[model samples]
Target: MKTLIDYLNAIPVEARDSFAARCGTSFDYLRQVGYGNRACTERLAINLERESGRELVCELLCPDADWAFIRAAPPPGRRRGRARNRTT
Candidate 1:
């Protein structure tokens, strides 16, 4: 099976730097995460997804979490609650 690092490394060299920049990370840092030397955080996963259009969060980061619930959750620093009442 191809590891995440393998997949990442397979991308064209010319595009690698752009991917890293778009993810707001360096290739070295991403390589470390792919190698399991560093933990994959949700924020980073979201960035990667946004930049690459690949949802690696479940496969890489929160594999044990309920992804369905995660998908239902609001964005960062936000919550699901009732709206305010209108003044009469």
Candidate 2:
């Protein structure tokens, strides 16, 4: 199986740093999540894609993805609570 390190290595170094900066986080934090040491939250993934201008979804679905982390991607948005109760 492919490792987290392998995936991270695949991303260009400049892209990584640019993403880290756009996320308002340090490179270490990015590494932590990218390398699977930390959880990859939806916000983080969104930030990564938005910031890095890369397709994180593609990366997550890659054959080399860490299943645990890949599964952690947030579920699709659903209407709930008052929003669902309202009859627009």
Candidate 3:
């Protein structure tokens, strides 16, 4: 079976850290689930969706997420604004 890391790694590298950060998680968390040390959580999944600008978890777990809308990545050549929104 393909592992979570397998899926995570498939995500674009630029999307990785933000995905984890938005998920209110860290790469360690990804490693845990990816390495089979933890179970997936709704919060984590939701955060990832928010981070990646994709609608995977919501489509798979919560029907309400389908309409939740995807957040667009900043246009190419533009970096995200200050990292003030981060919580860690």
lDDT of each: 0.73, 0.60, 0.62
Which is the leading candidate under TM-score?
A: 1
Question: Residue 36's C-alpha lDDT in candidate 1?
Answer: 89
Worst 10 residues of 2 by lDDT: 55-64
Models 1 onward score TM values of 0.65, 0.46, 0.45
lDDT per residue for candidate 1 within 1-88, as digits (tens), equals 3455876888799899888888788888889989889877777777876665564444455355466877898998876897677899
- For residues 23-85, write the lDDT of model 3, one tens digit per residue: 788877876866668765666666655655553444443344433334355666667877556
Candidate 3: list runs displaced more than 4 Å: 1-3, 11-15, 58-88
How many angstroms is residue 64 displaced in model 1 relative to the true structure, after the best TM-score fit? 5.9
Question: Highest lDDT among the candidates is held by which one?
Answer: 1
Worst ten in a row by lDDT for model 3? 61-70
Off by over 4 Å in 2: 1-18, 58-88
